[model samples]
Target: MNAEPRPQESLSGKEISPTDPARFPRLGFLLGLVVVYWALYFVVGAIDKPYFYGFIYGLASALLFAICFFTWWWGNRAIRRSEKILGFVLIVGVGVLVGKFSDRTVNFFPLCTLGLPLVATLVLGWLALVKRSLISSHWLGFAAAVALGFGVFDLIRMDGFDSSLKTHLSWRWTPTAEQRFLAENAASAAAVKPSVAKTVPLHADASTWTAFRGPNRDGVAHGTNVPTDWNSNPPQQLWKRAVGPAWSSVIVIGDRVYTQEQRGPVESVVCYDAATGQQVWAHDDETRFDEAVSGAGPRATPTFAEGRIYAFGGTGILNCLDAETGKVVWSRDTKNDSQGKPPMWGLASSPLVTDKNVIVYGGGEANKSLLAYHQDTGNLAWTAPAGQQSYSSPEIVTIAGVRQCLMFHDFGLTSVDPATGRKLWESGAVMKGAPRTGQPHLVDGNKLAVAVLDGPGVSLVSVTKEGDQWKVAPVWASKDLKPEFPDFVVHDGSAYGFDSSIFCCLNLATGKRSWKDGRFGRGQVILLADQGLLLVVSESGEAILQAADAQARKELGRFQALNGKTWNSPVVANGRLYLRNAEEMACYDLTPRRQASIR
Candidate 1:
């Protein structure tokens, strides 16, 4: 015991130096470092396209690279044991915190933030192996941390990521010039009249349902009497035929019931017999776009004017067809003229036809905002500065005795001179969202009623004139009357429209709710002023006829027509009611004489 005590005292005076390993597996550690670095880079690269994801991924990469390099460089230093432990813990904690924040901030595909923890664990493991004597239990801890971090990230990603990723990835490439040209012509053809050889009128009262509204571009129909009520049991199913997959409403003119449908590889322009609902003629063009919402079909209501039926397809193909026969006369490419891509839901806005020019919202940037084409030929008439494409159709209405084409884009309400496409009055009516699908309604003749779903409720603007200058001011606004699909119709000083899940009636003057209660289901509606009724075709194929009033919301009658969802707004013309679902079209005679006994 005495000899050992003397030896311990001598050892205390001498310096204790831990022997450095002859070979510390430097190549293996470097190889692992390179592997981890490239893996992290690959992950970051995957999410660096969309600007929001790019910033987050960049931050993650910076943190990961810092951790990796610092750990590798200073890991073997003979620092104090407690200090070393604290530094290692701090590095890992910082890495994990950065990764978690990145994951939360950039909520998009593939999860680039997950690579942060993976890189940290790899670096820490490499450092621990290189400097084994300095730290203990680090390898086990790193393994656990990496496994937990990856598991948590994957779980969050699964829940947060929208299913639109698959669709977006498929259409990443920019369309070719030919494709773009085709889209533009398709859009032009959708709104412009085709110069065709004169033929006898199929019906005495052939009128074009040009835009989403009608010939007047308003839901109000004059010159014809439409039945207000119908029989109880299925009424009279005049004609029911299989149509392609489309939600576009049927526009009746003469003997032709013009509409659009999507079959396999083509979004076909189908013309049917107005009386019997029989197929008259059809024109099919290959629209290879495979989309999700509205499916792969034409979304625009064919505008029939001056012997031409103008149709806009899902992929932005505007075609001018002969009203009598489905023949392409002349076409213009809207996609080219506007230098814009199709909206995610496709070019859904129905074409607008003025006296001699066909007006349309291009939804592009620069030289192609709102465009006007010659009705006879597909010649470009005039172009407005490109703004935002809206699913809403353009309207030509007179505000303060001045004829102006009113267009609601993603930015706001724009009034352009229809004759020249010149901007008359631009109001700061920017919607919260980038796209608007509902048509604008003119309330009380002086006020403009516009509805945007999931954004602002409804904005009622007063259109006044100060000499040559026009002024638009917000009179009232309400979030309750958000029109999802069908445009609101103002009648008797009140606005009547369906707001997503419910139908609401609001005072157009004050945006005040008078009465709102109806389980009309999620479907588009068109108001029949003559009948004083709202024809709502629900998503589940049920059509409900309700009184267009705030005080007494009476359901006149309800009937089921198509097998699929009824997205098309019901059309009442020539004592006949036209309704369509995704795959089937039906016509019902609602003449007062036929259903007089039932009522």
Candidate 2:
């Protein structure tokens, strides 16, 4: 006996059968999931703490996959039977083939959501609905996907990731920021300038900024009064020029500014004129440190002390250069000297130049994490324990009437004697597997504030010194202000910095948030202590001035400082403001002239 005719419907001028056998049977369901998948991506940026952006985006992408896999199993109650087993085999085989042959950087989440779901619905769904062919559609799809795996992705490349963990992709043939800068500068290059480092005096009062995060490494500019009224007394651009790719902040002394950059394969310590923004000298090391996560170049800033420029390269080389001319005084292989493995993002510890020794954190190993070499002789002075990893630089501060060197590592905060490399005190780590960044902020001389990513945020560790021993413990741990990589500064009994991507103020006394306002990405804040003002340089290179009050936030003025993703810290010295990122550097005249200039 003949079976009753199957129900037929017309879609797009083609006759369709509802129960027709098909390679991708649940096209309607997949269409719905794709809609939901796209919606999830649109909202992931709205999540708090950009470092936690993966939590939402991963969950949303996994939800559709989990449901797809579950339904695939549940609907096929007899999938093991001989008659129904072919579809199962085909599904598993196609997945394995595509995964194994696709480009290494091609993520599965995007593949499943964007490529497979949508295309399968169009091709297999149409064939199943029209010709009622399951095996043919399956074979055709397998062939098409295999072709895509070997052909389409070879032309693409991953540039890097933003703070939100979103992948930045580009064409493989496109020129990078460093390459474009090199080509442009070489075309119109002028004659090489002589060394001006000798003409400028390196010695200055406490006002000169010769270290990362300013003179004290506290991210505070003391005594200078920055003009807050940008409308009335706007900043004038002294000079704007392109620089090599680097995350290093600039250090200013006299009329000279020094920083690090990656030029081609060489990591250079470049000295530029603070007045003309001219290149005076550059000490190049024949090495390169390039990674996809944070792009490339040096992460630590150059330190200036006692007529010497101390710079730590990204690949773990330390060099002491003469401040008079760019001559190498002494060089040490820090990675080889300490015998420790480098971190994922490279050794970013900005060298701390003390009276006798230059101290830096170590790689993973017992009693080898903190290495202090002689300042002039380049001899290994001493080594201390500092856990496995840290991007934080060693800081010199006086706590409880005792001067000690402070360093932040994966585990926690460690205070050591600068002269002896003795471990004075240690605190426990907050976020496991998350290496600490940003130097420790010492509040009230002893209270230390340290922050971590994807963890319980910043913790206030109380450091005190007793008769013969030292003690360190957390006074209050909180998520009130998670600065990620940017350093926070304490002023007027209150701490101010970025809470992930937003600007926030925290009361250092109570750990309570005074007020949280503004989205500044991952930028640094320089507290102009004399003017009671805060100069904020955002990740996208906008400089904003706001009232440094704990009660309420008020924006005084803002101006475009640079034109790229800015992660490096800014420097202000001798009536000038200097800012740089991976792309370019600029000198602005904040010299109380009250004139606006843009070039």
> Best-fitting candidate, measured by TM-score?
2
Q: For residues 3-97, what per-residue lDDT tens digits would candidate 2 score against the true structure? A: 97665422222334545432223345545655665566567655655565564456556656546744754474322333235434544465556
Q: Residues 1-599, candidate 1, lDDT per residue (tens digit)?
A: 44332211011122233352222224355457657766866774544133224445656665666576557545644343444565466555644554565433233223333444455555456544535443444445544654554444433322122211211112223442224434654664577554433233743253434445577666765544544455534356677766666668888775568888876667788887776655667888887444433344667788877778888776777788887888899777688877777876677767777868887766766647687888888898998863567777778788788888877777777788888988888775565336676766776677777775224578777889998777788786787676655566777788877765577788776778888787555566667776577777776678777788878688888878666555677776766777875567788776545542320
List the candidate 2 regions with Cα displacement exceeding 4 Å.
1-3, 6-24, 50-152, 188-199, 430-432, 453-455, 592-599
For candidate 1, the lDDT comes to 0.64
Cα-based TM-score, every candidate: 0.66, 0.86
Name the lDDT of candidate 2.
0.75
Q: Report how far residue 142 has shifted in candidate 2, in Å.
A: 6.1
Off by over 4 Å in 1: 1-211, 223-234, 431-433, 453-455, 592-599
